[model samples]
Target chain A: MKKIESLSEYRALLGENKKTHNGIDKNCFLLPSGMEKFISAGKVYYRSYDQGILIFIDENSYYNLYYYIEKGSCFPVFSCEKPVLIEELSQNGSRDAYIAANEARLKAAGFGFYRKSFQYEIGIGAEEPQRFCTAEDEQAVKASGFRYDTACYADFRPQIISLWKESLDFGDISGDDLALELSQDEELLTVISGDGAVACTYLYEIVGRDVSEGRHVVTNPSYYRKGLGSFVLGLTLDHLRAEGIKRHYTWIHEQNIPSVRMHERLGFLQNGRSSIQYILK
Target chain B: MEEMMQILKGVRPDVDFENEKLLIDNKVLDSFDIITIVSEFNENFDIEIDVEDLEPYNFNTIEAMWELITKLQEEG
Candidate 1:
């Protein structure tokens, strides 16, 4: 295992791999102020072994109006579980072998057993237009200063792409050469603030079989305590209710109570989270 | 490493400098510290790095960082 002491040193080595080979993503950024607090008071380190990367973020301000940012592919599955470092699993390690290693790490680290958690994936927009919202109301809401800026998919392509890197859990974000996305098939709307607070959403037409899903409703850190989550959800529901789109799905990390509460406040009920598995080695 | 020296000087002039690695070791640069550095690097180098590059490796040490910055410059 290599101990990474400096950002530059870590980068030089990782440049030989995906951590560097992959370009930057905008939505993945943390507010500079929040980062300052973390740096001055917190310690974050990443270890690169022959197997894979292990990131440790310490001194995190947990349960204090939290937000879910970057996560690995298994995040949705792992939920509250951090991978236990055992003898690095071989690239060819069996699934059972990896699971065994995790069990060993948990036992060794004394990491308590984790209870399975559930998250929701609501089905939205499968039905025809029902409730409709006028541009005037949308503008008035923005003019009132509660909503920062209201831009629909048509109005928000560059806007969405501008924050696109936030979508890292789903794909390879490289050479896309664009910020914001305008969808012929999907609709997205969001509001951004000068302080880097973001709570916007994407509305998909259908889900799992024909089920529709609401991609996300995120409230940035700067505006965490400001009820921005409710505001975004209010707008989304208004829009969905108008178009008669219902049964939408969104993911909330099981541990983020505030966000889950916000969603529940907006009438999003819970569904189960399918387990996500990974082999880092 | 020179890129790092120049970056550090531009961001923090209050302190005398030595090994670029000392900045991280001495607690002068942390995560947020790293963000500011990346932001500044973007402005000065005309290269863009966002969330995907937030690894400790990218800006952990001056000499170590040159590899990524140089690569970005080339890609640019």
Candidate 2:
């Protein structure tokens, strides 16, 4: 596995496999638009194999593996901070090949299969201003005494961090670092309680002109079963629809049956997309 | 304890909640399962278990969950 560093090197590698590179499209593999983002990110690792090129983008605790096989075939594995979560599968690779390629190394390093996230992409329509919240959801929010507020980043900073801590189990994520990333996005929706935030979700611009990435739909675990998750998701979807965003895409863990159900209820399709995660102990 | 086990089984009949103690640590039960189980506990016991009480330690075992309910009920 050779480390692909410069743009020239990456391009040369791609040039070696032009036939495979040409087949990728938005509807298929998650091919990188450019190597510039990966190179500049500074933690990216690349290697050339007999039939494909392996690219690993390490985002501190989370790492994304992009295995570009010959003929434009690609597979991606998105990992959580602790490396315990093996997420996302390739559209073209076989399960055996995927496991053989990475499973041994991951297992030797102490990880195990945590969960799987099913990717969803939806086409948004220009609907009238309507509520996505259910009666039960509204009642739960009211009973819990949390307020829905569309506040600026400054106001949302401290509360959002706490919510992340309570919802996500990975301890490697630093609240300060997360705050820095959250500041980059322009849109946010939050459910707040007394002096704190209970639930929140945000949207960030993607590479395409009208596509936005829906991210970090988190709620404090203490507030679970109170409809906070649905409330936040509904508010975010309504806002996105109003913005005329053509498509919305997100990954929901297979284990989160309620979330999957909620998204389906909101009209997002399963799309028959599957990703595999291999955890090591 | 039996009641808690019954509810757990009802939510996830496939899992042997009586024997599986690593429910939370092993990720056997996902977030949604935890949410459902918590809701059931709240409704059946008439106790409000806030998010702060939702740590993995409390839901890892039927015994731990029963203890949590008892504590919350007594506190109320």
Candidate 3:
């Protein structure tokens, strides 16, 4: 296997694999610009073998490995300073083959199945609207000096990193990743701040002309039960609606009952798609 | 082109679409803005703009957008 340093070469190899494997969807992989940004941020590492390419995305505490195999065989070998997560989107049928091929290596590396997450989706106007935050809650939040606004990624990078470190168990993002995403036209990071602290944050990506994905939402643990999450999410949804986004979706772990309930209350329903994560320490 | 400018202004009044050539590259227009523009163009021009036609090259400037709309109308 040879290390791929140039973005053009990486793209060409990916394009060749796509041309050969008709079932592969390019969208499943990170966009070229995103890959370039991550590489520039020094957070992305990738290599190519005879059969395919493997990409390792370095988050602060963990790594995410994404691979494209030409012969339908998937096995990635890499060293990491922290835990590594390998996720398989359920929409792809090759997940079974991928796991089968990598099972032995993963076990040898002390990896185990982590958890299964279900995808939830909602149409902007397809269903009757439900208020995630009541007028009273909004008024209270506002009166308390908590204000919601969209901001550049740098505005709350430190706060977000701190909050995710304390609250999130998986898919924790790094400041470099956030900085890279800020360069994209479709990424939006909204926040609620007051009293010299960021109370809550919502980050999403506009995936298509009328579709957006809820990437991450984190509220300072100290602000829990204050309706900050609901308040911020409601405003974010309204912003998305005004921007002509017709659909929104997100993934939540099945065991996360509170998050499941909150999303359900906000009108998101399970979309019958699920993915599994395998983690190696 | 003036009519197109009107539509663009209607979506985002702050931008000077006439002189700003790098609408997509400069981040003058975001994905949301693009969606609104596409919807407006499709309805106003009675031309179908497929997802394939939503590339940055076709929308980086008023001239590029007009050319794309004209091409789509001609194809129709």
Candidate 4:
């Protein structure tokens, strides 16, 4: 029901509402609280309770929420770029009823529609400072095999995590935790070899089509001189480009020199695109 | 072991896969390595790996990685 327009406004709304939600902890919640940088040119909007039953609405992009329904104690609706194709949960019975009513309201108001991807895109290759292209280092770098394999979120950790624990950087990330984060859709990758793997880059979250972001790129001190960091990103970039994606992004701390340089090498030269997650006890 | 060594050396001439598990630890491979490897895997093996498949497990140790390559090849 609430339509927040500007980033500042969204922040204010988020601060006010995040406290009201349940199931969040005070510590270890690393994600955006309220963000609205639409990948499509149309304005992006998000409105959700503190518990994160948030709905991202963009005039440009689109989603089909009704298609994937997982029933539990209650299935919170996820992904409905348009209300017409969606149905929200309801307190009276199910979230679907609420979504249905909301859909009717939107239809009556003549506001149900699809906009486009955000005007600002995280390109892969660009001569510009912060711009990017679909693929980085194409035809330039040969596959020497020291190639790392990267995946996302915590739920998707494999045996290699425990096998190669001594070489982790990114400030003491354990294999178990990393695996769980991978399940959360966080971007995770590894540069691998026979006796070693060097850098590992991962993001806490990646959403929608406009942009996908990685959290950090952790390099092994032993492999500092080589361009392993660039290699991981180049691989990710090529995969993304192959999928017809237009933009990609990853969050690097302001002071992480190596990471910033690596992202710069990959062409994600923006100053910042971060969302602080709020946890409730 | 030989195939894994070949992949590792292909990625970097100075790689030491003997006691070093690449994905489990950041030793010889890094971002640059991942890109090159992904390209090679995609081209040499003729398989399209989705962005979602990029992870440590996919290219962790030589044995684990060989499993991925073998599986992908089989799937194809």
| Ten contiguous residues minimizing lDDT sum, candidate 4 chain B | B24-33
**Highest TM-score against the true fold, candidate:** 3
Per-model root-mean-square deviation over C-alphas: 19.2, 20.5, 10.2, 21.4
The best-first sequence of candidates by TM-score reads 3, 2, 4, 1
**lDDT of model 2 at residue A159?**
68
Two-chain DockQ for model 2: 0.01
lDDT of each: 0.45, 0.58, 0.69, 0.43
Please identify model 1 stretches exceeding 4 Å from their true place: A1-117, A121-143, A146-159, A162-184, A190-205, A208-210, A279-281, B1-76
Q: Across all candidates, what is each one's fraction of true contacts kept? A: 0.06, 0.00, 0.00, 0.00
* TM-score of chain A in every predicted structure: 0.41, 0.66, 0.72, 0.42
Query: What overall lDDT, based on C-alpha atoms, would model 4 receive against the true structure?
Result: 0.43
Interface RMSD after interface superposition, each candidate:
17.4, 19.5, 10.6, 17.1
For A1-281, candidate 4 gives per-residue lDDT tens digits of 34555655644654454445432211111112212343132344444532343434432223212111111113332333233223221111212333443444344434343321111124643323332222344223334434345443132244335433554543222455555554443344544332443334433233433235554455555656666566656666665555555456554444556666656655455531222111111
In model 1, the Cα lDDT at residue A266 comes to 57
lDDT of 1 by residue, A1-281 (tens): 23345544534544554453333212124433344443354354445433334444442221111112122222212222233321211111212343454454334434434432344533345453332334665565466454454464454455455454554332212214223223433445555443333445433333222234455555444445655556666556565554554445565555668767877765566643222222221
lDDT of 3 by residue, A102-204 (tens): 5665566566888888888877743436644568877888899887788744676777766766765645444555555555677888888888788888889
Question: Model 4, DockQ value?
Answer: 0.01
> Candidate 3 vs candidate 4: which has greater DockQ?
3
Clashing pairs for predicted structure model 3, backbone only: none
What 10-residue stretch in candidate 2 chain A is worst by lDDT?
A23-32
